[model samples]
Target: MFSSLKIRNYRLFATGAVVSNIGTWMSRVTQDWLVLSLTHSSAAVGITTALQFLPMLLFGLYGGVIVDRYPKRRLLLVTQGSMGFFGVVLAALTLSGHVQVWHVYLIAFFVGVVTVVDNPTRQSFVSEMVGPKQVRNAVSLNSANFQTARLVGPAVAGVLITSIGSGYAFLFNGLSFIAPLVGLTLMRPGELQKGHTVKRGKGQLREGLRYVKGRPELIAPIVLVGFVGTFGFNFPIWLTAFANTVFHGGAGMYSLFNILIAAGSLIGALLAARRRSTRLRLLIFAAASFGLLEVLVSFSPFVWLFCLVLVPVGMMGMTNNISANTTVQMAAEPAMRGRVMSLYMMVFVGGTPIGGPLLGWVTDTFGARVGFASGGAVTLIAALAIGFVLVRVIGVRPKMGLRNGMPYVELVPRPGSRAEGELASAA
Candidate 1:
């Protein structure tokens, strides 16, 4: 699982990422808490979250086109620095007792603007550092790093937010950027394996859409993630509402919830890192399991049971994410990676602007349990719908029976068909 760290550049990247990711998590927790404190409304929290991702919804494809034409390392420097600047600015405002909800909104939107570029650049940059052989492992390890940070960041942020204030957490986040900047600066340029960069031209955006539209495998995962992300992954809104209204707790309870989820996510990521294969069927199963768990957990009669169930929810969610991500990255040609990944991120996170406020309103009007269960129901339905589409696309039928005294489930191609013939020859 740590095999990717043998490459010096990736080691540096991972080290820096862990530090920055911790700060990122800290900022996320503090940001949500701050908004809730200010507005005393879950809808406001949803709006803040939506503003932060709105740019990706509006301009994600354009950002991908730009990434395809530029050097990722250089682009990262600018984007990272910009994000750090925003962190500090927010910190200064909060520290000065002048921060307001609108200030947070403006900054969140700007940060989202920068992310339109940063998300795709960072995703495609892994191949340049670790090479194709380690891409899946590296991606998994990256998730592990982020999840590990999640374990630490929220706990620390909770204490800081309760004791010192949100400003210091924001400050730590701003300063955390230094680690990544130094890592980027220290990398040996000669060791990099840069991919092909597209020249400035027209119709590239349309070209990318067409590329994905024609491939059922690629479209399937993307569509599945779109549903999961938009509806199921609205954790910020759900967690905040549950902790505040349902449990009648403060930052500590919220932090604990995140820590539990992160611990499970860390386990999932490590498992993914050890694997050598990415399968669409596994992605679908993971997603389905994740949604079902959410439904079950939403109705937990006790807080302890609710928290306990969150672990597997996080695990299956991470598994679904890594599987989909690795599948797309590995399948796309290196030349179109930036555009493809940009589209992927766009669909995955961009839906937040639409889902966030809607879910928040549900939580606000109907209560957290109803809101949470509704989102889970949507996710489960989407997974089954997309799974059916994939079954038809791949010409496979789901089979279930007893194998060696154990129940087994698998997908088998239709008999006497082209896909079946190909499978038989391969076997």
Candidate 2:
């Protein structure tokens, strides 16, 4: 599972990434808490989240085009530095006792702007570092790395926020950029597995869009993630409301919720690393299960029960994410990887601009339970819809059977076609 770390360059990158990821998580928790404290409203928190991702929703494709034309490592250096700088700016503002809600909004939007390039660059760079064979493993490890950080960062940030202040969390995040910079600097250029970069040309954005439009395998997963991400992944708004309004807790409770999810996510990533396939069937099942769990947990009458359900929720969510990521990365050609990943990330995250506020409004207008369940309902519906589309596209029919006195459904492929083999493995 850790095989990807044997490579010297990838090892360096992973080490740096983990450190930065921890700080990123810390900032995330602190940022949410800070916004809630200042505004005392989940809707406000949602707006803050929305502003941060709005840039990606608007210009994410262009960022992909730029990533395709540039060297990923070099672009990473610039983007990472900018992120750190923004963190420090926010830290300074908070530490000075002059920070306002608008200040946070402005900075968050800037960070989102930078993320457009950084997200795709970092994703496509994995292939360059570890090559094609190790891409799936490396991707799993990366998720594991981020989830491990999620386990520690939020808890630490909670304590720090209560004892010191949110400013320190931001400061730590800013300083964390140094690790990635150092790692990037130490890498040997001659050892890199470089791919062909797209030339500077017109219609590159349209070209990327057209590329994704024609492929059902890519479009299916992308559409599934787009709906799931926009609706199902608005945990920030839901968790904050649940902690503050439902459970009557503070930052500690919020942090605990995140830690639980992170634990499950870590387990999911590790399990994914051991698996050899990245089938669409797996993606659909995981997503369906995740949505169901979310819907059930939304009605939890006790905090303990609610928290208990989050573990599996995190696991299935992580599984769904890894499956989609690996499928897209493996399907796209190397030359088009940056643009493809950019489009994927665009839908996966850029939808936050719409989902964040909408979910926040739902949580605010109705209640946390209603809001959470609504999101889950949308996710479950989307999974089933997309699964049906895939079935028709692949010309697979469902066969019902009884096994061990239990009923089950399976996809049977058409006779004398390649889809039969695909369905066999995918099923």
Candidate 3:
């Protein structure tokens, strides 16, 4: 589980990433609160979220093309610096009392711009730091780092927002970028593991799309993640509305709720790190379980109960995320990894533009409960629908079997099929 950390460069990368990730989460919480504080409209908040992710939706695949064409380490420096600059500008505006919802939206849009390049580069960059053999563990540990930061960042942001104001949180996040920058500079390039990079060319983006489109195993999970990401992952809108309106709580309560979920996610990530293999079927079940948990949590009568339910919700959600991410990263050819991952990120996060406002509208018009329930129902339906498709298109056949005296699912693939061969080692 801790195997990847033994690599000196990855150790540096992970250390720096943890610090920066905390700041990232801090900015996320504070940014949403700031937008809501200024506008008092969930739709306005959704707009900010949409602006932050829109660039990824539009240009993420192209950014992946760039990642494949350039040295990821150098590319990261530029993108990370750009994001931190936006953080600082936003902080300065808020500190001077000149911040507006529009200011937040503009800055968020620019930050999203940088993220289009940064997210996929950083994801695929892991291959350069550690070999494919350790990719699964490294991915899980990377998520563990992010979740651990989530546990700390939001709770701290809530206190900071209530006490020092949101400006300080943004400023802290801006300054925190220095850690990763320093880590990158300190890396030993000679010791790094290298992956394939592409040369400049036309139709490269189309090539990546065609690559995934041709693989049913690949397309299946990507589509399922799209639904889960667009609908099921609209927790920011729902959680904020529920904490403030339904539960009648302030930043502290909101922070506590986030903390509980992060704790559960941390547990799930660590457990995933212990796994020797990942499977698409596990991802399916985890996503379905996550949707069910969300449905249950959305209807919690009390805040404490809601928070308790969030543990399993976060757990299954993280499991689905980590498992799918590992599978996708492992499946792609190294040369096309950037573009493929860019498409994955594009679907996963870029769809926020559509989902955020839709969910926000559902919250504003109908109430947060209906919005949450609707999102979960959609997610549950998506999982079922996609699972059926995978069975039919990929020729998945299932049988009941016993393992350690416990009944388990056994997949019997069609004889002499591509997907059947892929499924043999998919885990």
Candidate 4:
């Protein structure tokens, strides 16, 4: 399960990421809390969230293209450094009492721009560090590491906000980037995974679009993730609002909600790591289940009850995410992996910018309950639609195939004539 950590470079990266991710989560909590404290409006908080993620939606494809064309390691070093600087600037502004809503908006937008390039590079870089054989393990472990940080970071941020102030949380997050920078610099160049360098040309973006268009199974998962990510996974914003308005609590309750969700996510990541085969059918089922649970949780009358449901919600979410990630990576040709992963990142993160504010507006106009319910309903419908479409696209008959024995439609493709001939020859 922990086999991927045996790789020296990956271990270093993982360690640095764990430390850095904690700070990232810390800043996230504080940032939201600060916005709410200043504006006292859920819409303002939602706009802040949207600004932070909007760039990824707009420029993520180009970022992926750059990752495919350039040296990923060098790119990461630069991006990480830039993020640290941005964090420090925000911290300074907040500490000096010069911070305004517009300042926050601008800073969030800048960070989103940096993330457009950083996210795809980071995702593709993992395979280079651990190799294809350990890719699934590496991906699962990476998410586990992230969620573990989520569990620790929010609780710590809550305490710090209550004690020191939100500015200190930002300061800590700024400093946290140092670990990853040092780790990147320390990696032996000889130990790095060499990637295929694609030639830059006109229509490269169009080429990627066409590449995805050719694979319906691949397209199905991307669509499924886009829906779930945009609608169902607005927990960071929704939970914060819910805790404050509905539960009549503050940072502590927000932290508790994140902790419960992260607990379930950690379990989901561990289970995913143990799987020998990552299948698309599992992805669909997980996504569908997650959406359904979100709808159920929306109706909860108590904070504890809402938190309780997040366990299953988090579990299914992680399952869907890891399964989609592993399947996409495993199916793509090595030469096009960066491009495909970029599209995945674009759909996944980009959806948030579009969805966040819309959901926020719904919450503001109606109520958090209705807003959450609407998002969940959209996710459930999308998941079911994608599943049915994939069933037909993959040519999986209802009977006579091994898939019939399973519950959902698996994505593993059948052997072609040449592969069958090769098996006969070996026999």
lDDT of 2: 0.90
Model 4 / residue 302 / CA error / Å: 1.8
Candidate 3: which pairs clash?
Answer: none
Clash numbers, per candidate? 0, 0, 0, 0
How accurate locally is residue 89 in candidate 2, as Cα lDDT from 0 to 100?
Answer: 96
TM-score of each: 0.93, 0.93, 0.93, 0.92
Q: For candidate 1, lDDT tens digit of each residue in 1-427?
A: 8999999999888888899899999999999999999999999999999999999999999999988999999999999999999999999999999999999999999999999999999999999998877888999999999999999999999999999999999999999998999899999888888667999999999998988885655787788899898899888899999899898888999999999999989999999999877766789899999889989999898899989999999999999999889888876778898999999999999999999999999999999998998888888888888887656656765444445543333456777655688778989
Model 4 RMSD in angstroms? 5.2
Model 1: residues with Cα > 4 Å off, grouped in runs:
393-427
Which is the winner by TM-score between candidate 2 and candidate 4?
A: 2
Tens digits of per-residue lDDT, candidate 3, 308-350, equal 8999989998999998787787767788889989998999989
Tell me the spans in candidate 3 whose CA falls farther than 4 Å from its real position: 397-413, 416-427
> What lDDT does candidate 2 reach at residue 45?
90
Model 4, range 1-427, lDDT digits (tens) per residue? Answer: 8999999899889999999899999998888888888898777888898898899888888988898898888999999999999999999998998988888889999999999888888889988898777888999999999999999999999999999888888998999999999888888778876777788899878888888885655677788899988998887668877988888998999988988899999999999999877766788899889989989999999777898898988999999999888777776666777888989988987888889989988888888888888889999999988887656444431211223232122234334544345446879
lDDT of each: 0.90, 0.90, 0.87, 0.85
Looking at candidate 4, the ten consecutive residues that score lowest on lDDT are 397-406
Off by over 4 Å in 2: 393-427
